[model samples]
Target: MKLQDSVIAITGGGQGLGRAMAEYLAARGARLALIDLVPEKLEAAAEACKAAGGDARAYTCNVAREADVEATFASIIEDFGQLNGVINNAGILRDGLMIKARDGEISKRMTLAEWQAVIDVNMTGVFLCGREAATKMIENGDKGVIINISSISRAGNMGQSNYSAAKAGVAALVPVWAKELSRYGIRAMGIAPGFIETEMTASMKPEALEKMSAGIPLKRMGKPEEIASAAAFIIENDYMSGRMIEVDGALRL
Candidate 1:
C-alpha cells in the first residue's frame, strides 16, 4: 500500500521504537494518530511527526484496556475519516525468574501480578488493538496492514518467564491473524527485535550492555530506525504477511 496520505495509527508512539516508526512513516507522507498512555509524551511525539511534514495527532490511551483501545480507534477513524494501518508497538517488561532460591532457601519467585501485567500489555493489548483495527478496516473496505512488535526473548530468555511467554504469544499471532484476516485484504506481520538501543535497554548497566552486545554477531545493539525500516517494507510490500522479520543483528538469545 502507498503510504502517502494514508492514515496510520501507532500505539506506544511516544518513545523508543514507536517514536522512530512514527517519524519514519511521517517522513513518507503518512498521516499519523499517535497513541500513548502519557499525554505529554504523546503530544511531543505528535509534534515531532508534524515537524517531519505529516499531519499528526496525539491520543492518550492505554492499549491494555479494551475500552481505551476501542475508543481510541473510534476517535482515530473520526479524525482521519479512514484508518489504513495499525502498529501494535505498545509493550512493557516485568522480567523475573519463575523461582529464585539462595543456599537451599527459597528467596523469591515471579509474582502473579508481574506475569499478568506483562501479558495484559504485551499479549492482550495486541489482541485488542488488532481486533479493533481489523474491524474498522473491514467495515470501511480498506486494505490495510497490522505490524506487531515481538522480541528475541520470544525464543525464551532466562529471568524473563513472563516477558518471554508474552512475546512468544505475540509471534504466534502473526500467522493466525494473517490467515484470519486475509479474506479482508488485511495483512498481519511481526518484527522481533533483539537488544535494540532503546530506553528499555539503556537502563542496563554498562558492563551488562557490553556483554550483551558482544554476544550478538554484529557486536552492537540495533537502532530503532532499522526496525522502522522493516515496518515500512512490510507496509509497502503487498505480498508480505504471516511471517516475522527479525532485526536482531543475528542475535539468537
Candidate 2:
C-alpha cells in the first residue's frame, strides 16, 4: 500500500479536494491518473502534480458514463502499466427540498432531473469507477484501495434531499465493496467531510459560511489538505477498510 511509484486514479481531479489529493499524493511519489470532465482543469491538475515531482497524466472523463469510466481506466493501466488505487471523488450538488411549501401550500418540488443528475454523478459514478478499478486490480493480483468521498449531508440535511440521498448511498457502498472485494485484495473505505473550504463552499454567501462554521466545534472550516492527509493515511494503512472516517471537525448536520 505504499504510495511511492504506485499508480492511483482520481476522479474530479480538476479542482477542489480532488486536486489537493492529487498534489499531496504526488508529493509522496505516487503516479497519478487525473480524471475530470473539463480538459483544461484536468490538464492543470496534472501539471500541478508534475510540479509536485510526480509522474501524472490527465484524462477527460465523465465518471457517470460507463463507457467513459471503463475507457479511462484502460488508458490509465496502459499508461501506468498498473492500477494501484482509485478515488471516487467526482460529485455535483443539486440541492432542493423534496417539496417546497409557501403559505402552507405546495409551491415547488424537487424535480426528477435534479435527483437523477446528482445520483448519476455522485452514486452511479462511484460504482462504475470502483468496479473498473477492482476488476483491474483483481486481474493483476494487486492489492489496492478505493476511497469514496462522502459528505456530512449523508446524515440528511434540509433542502438537500437529492444531495443527501446520493451521499448516503456513496457511504453505503463502502462496506459492501469492502466485504465483496476484500477476497480479491481490494480495500474499500469512505471519507465523509464536513464543510471544507473548497470552491464549492466558497460560493456560499459570507454570512452563510460564517454561520455554518460557527456550528462546528472547531468554529472553522477544514482545509482541502487536511482531507488529503486522511486519504494518504488510508492509502498507507493496509488494515483499514469497510468503514468511513469522518473528517468533519466534529460537525453533525
Candidate 3:
C-alpha cells in the first residue's frame, strides 16, 4: 500500500499510460516490474523508472497468452522476491463500426478476426494477468491490488464496437475481483479514462483534437500523468476497492 519499496508489475509499461505510471510510482519509491512485448521499450522504461528514484526491471511478454502471463508473473516474483500489485494496462485499438451501411444496404461489417483480436488482448489478457498476479500475491503472502485500465468508450462509442466491448468487460470485472480477492487482502479497481492526450491522440490533426476537446467539460484532454496519479491514489487508499474511477473531465460518452 505504501509506495515505498512496494513491488508493482505493470503491463504495457513500455510507453503511454503504462510508462507514465511506472515513472510516477517509481518517483514515490515503489519498485517496478515493467512488462511489455517489446524488449527495447521495456528496457528503456525500466531505466526511466530507476531514474525516477526507485528500483525497476523489465520483462518482455505477451499478456494475451496464458503461458506468457503465467511465466511473466512467476519471473516477477522470482526477481522482486515479493509482489504487491499489477496494473492491467496493455491494450490495442482496432476501431471500426460493427456495420457500415447506406440506405439500409451494408457496405462493411466488423470481421470476427477484428473482434477476436481486441477481445483477446484487451479482455482476456486482463483475465490471465490478473489471475496470475493474484495467485502469486496470495502464495507469497503479499497483500496487493489489481488495477484494470478501462476507458470511457466502455459506454459504447461509435466506430469502436470491439474496443467498447473489451473495455466494458474489464470494467465489469472490478467488483468480481474485489469480492473474490478481498479475503486474501487483495483489492481490485478500475480506471475509465475519457479522452486523454497520449501518443495516439497526440498525432491527431489539430482541428480534430480541438473538436474532441470541446465536448469535454474541462475543454481539454487528460494527461497520462493525471491517470497515473489516480492509480497511485487507488493503490494507497486501502479502503477503496471494486470501484471504477472516471477521470474523464466530466465528459460522457
C-alpha RMSD by candidate, in order = 1.0, 1.0, 0.9
Model 3 is weakest, by summed lDDT over 10 consecutive residues, at: 244-253
lDDT of 2 by residue, 98-158 (tens): 9989889999999999999999999999999999999988887788999999998999899
In angstroms, how far off is 82's CA in candidate 1? 0.9
Tens digits of lDDT, candidate 3, 1-253: 8999999999999999999999999999999999899999889999999999999999999999999999989999999999999999999988888999999999999999999999999999999999999999999999999999999999999999999999999999999999999999999999999988889999999999999999898899999999999999999999999999999999973
Give the poorly placed runs of model 1, Cα more than 4 Å off: none
Better of 2 and 3 by lDDT: 3
TM-score of each: 0.98, 0.98, 0.98
**Candidate 2 lDDT (Cα, whole model)?**
0.93
lDDT to native, each model? 0.93, 0.93, 0.95
Tens digit of per-residue lDDT, candidate 1, span 23-84 = 99999999999999998998999999999989899999999999999999999988998988
Cα deviation of 139, candidate 2, in Å:
1.4
Which ranges in model 3 have alpha carbons more than 4 Å from their true place?
A: none
> What pairs collide in candidate 1?
none
